[model samples]
Target chain A: MGATEMREPSFLILTALAGGPLHGYAVIAEVAQMSQGRVRLRAGTLYAALERLAAEGLVASSGEQVVDGRLRRYFRLTDEGEQALTLEARRLRENADRAVARLRTARSRVAPA
Target chain B: MTAGPEAAYRRLLRAYPASWRRRHADAVLGTLLDQADAEGRSAVSVADVRDILGHGLLARLHLLLDVVPGRVRAVAGTAALGSGAGLCLALLLLGEWLPPWAPPSTREAGFGPFLTVGPLLYAAWLLAVAASLLRHPRLARSLLGAATLAAVVLPHVVANAYPYAGVERPSSTALAPLAVLGLLVLAAPPSRPSPAVVAATAIGTVAAVGGPMLPLWLSGGSPFPVRDFFYYAYAHHLAVSAAVLLAAGLLAAVAALVARRPAYAGGALLALLPWAVLLLAVWRRISTQGMSALEPLVVVAGVGAALAVLGGLRALGVRVRL
Candidate 1:
């Protein structure tokens, strides 16, 4: 709620919804694909995260469609959600950049020595 | 066996609150079925079942926390602090008023005539609570931690220095207030208190205070004066169980009203399952002995059950609204 550190599942869920509105299963599939199958979002965890994100205005109901006689609700990121995602992305990028920079500096020192 | 996975999944989903199921059950179930189909599995995986059950309950608890008002949390926090302090004072007074013929275990650990270590330690705990209330949470937390540590250590020291036969060292009840205060300070955010913290504090305080008092009341009474420690322990457990049930019921009723959702009330009733089982056990024990010590517990159980049923019915589409 305070824009604190987002958990990996939540971050990935937001990432899955970044491209377009996706139904629950689609989002789960996309998240698995995005994480290279390292992180599989279960139905319960996915829904819970979606509910919290929705409550926080990071996501919203785009629409609903029936596929194979079962209802599938689509969720899309709101403007606020997109902004949050962008900020989180920037934060992660910076952290990665700093780590890489430190690694490069250490490598240069070791090589010269 | 054909419907095994779906049925199992549905049963697991029962862990979720009714309101949540009303909204997302169909879609979630569909997704689960889709995943099963995609993975070439015909049954719900053990991992999926565990995930559903674990996260479902947590989700409901999170929702429950969300419905509890900030004002209610603050009030409950204050009451917990007050009750903790009151219990300390009562224990100190009891030590002072212990009759000469009382059991040696009931005697004060022979610290001194007026000023003893236990009272001083409790006084320090009170100061810590006051500090926390005054917004000096860091200092208060440290002091409380120290006080609790002292409480834990002092008993061992006393046991070694002045060992007495049949002297049961002070129970966790003696340190409950400090523990509650510690929980409050730790769980409370800088800007606001979380609902989980408030609920835990409220429930913990009730259990800490009511647990001891109920046993005392039952044992101190006329019809069935239970003097033995065994009976006292049994009565104490019954009282604590009843208190927990009553508290859960009350919380559910209030949450239902505040959230305007009958599901919260139903959840509260669900919380009373253990209490009901405990009540039956108490009834069976007392009924065998022709004892009427169960009247109070029965009343509490009745009230809790009524509240739960009312809420559950309302959630199930009953026309009643309050």
Candidate 2:
């Protein structure tokens, strides 16, 4: 979609990596859990996002390893990425606050206030 | 504990690029193993293997796309270079082989010498291709086309200009076209980047023993050397030049690995190696006796090419301090 709508998944991905470096599968799992299972990521979709972020110099590759006969790669967010993530989170919180106030006002009117 | 699963995992890992694997393959595998251990012995299944394979492939593909810009249509220039190179190679082969097989009249009429058409044409073609490359740039095809065209024309020009008649194959004359060709070899497009990787287990395969095999079929030279202008001036010269280029290419590739910047490494090796080798040869000749008559013009051309590249890069907004 537009730039305004594109920030959600990126922010979520960065947040998932913020705790520490995480492999592809771990990042997907962590993000889903952190979002209360509201944001399950497909392998294609998650890696696609990871690639874009890496190109932008946001997320850097930490390392890779094999466990249980599967290859995995770990990534960590850069300082610039962390700052951008912080800004996005704040912007989102502000918007959410405005929506909650608007909903409250609408409920009062519906209650005959 | 299980060798079969580990081997399978390593095979799956091989799908990624070597550079990427160098950085992360081990960590990734370790994490996978940790997860498996946490799940216990009965945890493994076919689906898990499929998921691993699918994810590894996706990861590698994503990495490949990272080298180019995200805009699909805009990046078509690189794609054009690749195709152009292939077409040029095919054309080069046809130009080289078809002339011998042609009627004597056709050969006399310059059908055989038509291979020379490419180099002159390439000067214009390369400019256009480079413009297209830097502008909408077909990443691989444009370069490949230019190189193939150069290969055809350049060798023929050298052959015609200085017949390296048998027993008197002048080293100086023989090195000219090759030196020129070597400068442009790495810039010529490559086949698409390979995705093969190696896993942590099964000895990890960091060892191999094989020399760079010459492109024999493509060369198609007769077993015995000929004293004719065709063999001396053209064939031998081309063969030597190609071999030198092959050496320079290996040097460039190694430099790329060391530098961690493929483009810079390739450019450095291609531009410097030939000039260095030629410069040394020229210096040695001048020290022994006197400079060759063509030295002045060669120097001028070399300087001019450098300036042209500088100007082009400047116009494209790439700053060149020197």
Candidate 3:
């Protein structure tokens, strides 16, 4: 059966956690801010990503603590995670640069401006 | 307790397996309640329900995949390797591969169907098993498959062409050789998705253990007619049983390569213990009589027991490299 997929919001999630370890709700809020309110990660979507990331060794549990009378489990990026995120960031930047360069060439050719 | 956001979300949280819920439910519930508080809401949203149910089932599937094929098939592969090797050893020990007891026609020169097929398949299996041990599993698999196909065709060649052997119609493709063919196929491992590997392993195992005994079953618990090829006596019974234990150890070793702990091997050994004992217990009688009715049942039971033991280990927080 074809699986219904949640679009991977791992980049923004990793970017949010890059600053430090954060609990589930704090991550949701941080990702919202990081994405400039463009990629809103719901609780279900966030946990699913976190679970997959944890399984893949890209994320790990930092600790659990009590915050505001509720238990909050904190997650941190591992060294491997940092490496993966760095590689992805570099790749994405390279592609963006290439695209931008191509667009300038196209613009110059179209109107000679 | 009251019908509020926490209560409603708690109901939604039931979608996850109990173990998963235990680990992550409190955090997830906390997050959901926090989201609800920020939105000034008291009821669950449609999107929340959809994601929860969907991801919950997905998580359960992931958990099942981790336990089932991951360890069991690896163990089965090892066990099958043992069985394949054990069969070769048994044949040599019993003098069945060119058995001295056979009439002169069944000798190496005569090339009676089993005489030729048994040694060839077992030799290929031994080589494949060696290759697999050396971490050349892909090469081993190719050799094993080629050997099995060759074994399948050889019976016809030896039986039909070699009329000088004096046996009018040879059932070389019948029981024991078929089992060995099955072993070679099984020990080879399949195209290597865990499920496919497991299925191929299961079929090979049935053929290895049951293929030989099917003739005995048909013959109404009397000695089968084809003694020149494979002597279905004490040697055969002992070999089959030994194969079970040896193969169990082999797969467990493969698992240990991933687990890196001797305890993983111990788990597989413990699983096969009953089956080995059962076969040993009945083999003497089987050698004297036709075939033990319990042989097939014993094999299936042994495998089930092994899968259960490993699966239980997985549930108990013993992690494998899957």
- After superposition, which runs of candidate 2 have C-alpha atoms over 4 Å from their true positions? A1-9, A20-29, A37-51, A61-75, B15-19, B40-322
The parts of candidate 3 lying over 4 Å away from their true place are: A1-8, B1-3, B69-322
Clashing pairs in 1: none
C-alpha RMSD of candidate 2: 17.6
True contacts kept of 1: 0.80
Interface RMSD of each: 3.2, 7.4, 5.9
lDDT of 2 at A108: 88
* Ranking 1 against 2 by lDDT, winner: 1
DockQ of each: 0.43, 0.12, 0.29
Two-chain complex of model 3, DockQ on C-alpha atoms against the true structure:
0.29
Model 3 per-residue lDDT tens digits across residues A1-113: 00111233887777778899999988999988887888877787899899878876878999998767667889999887787777777777897999999999998899944
Q: Write the per-residue lDDT of candidate 1 for residues B110-174, one digit (tens) a residue.
A: 44431245566667667766675556656666766676677556655645223323333333334
Q: Candidate 1 — which residues are off by over 4 angstroms?
A: A1-3, B1-4, B63-67, B70-170, B178-322
Greater-DockQ candidate between 1 and 3: 1
CAPRI class of candidate 3: acceptable
Chain A TM-score of candidate 3 vs. true chain A: 0.89
Q: TM-scores of all models?
A: 0.52, 0.36, 0.45
Q: What share of the true interface contacts does each candidate keep?
A: 0.80, 0.24, 0.61
Candidate 3: chain B TM-score against the reference chain B? 0.40
Q: lDDT of each model, Cα atoms only?
A: 0.61, 0.46, 0.59
**Candidate with best DockQ:** 1
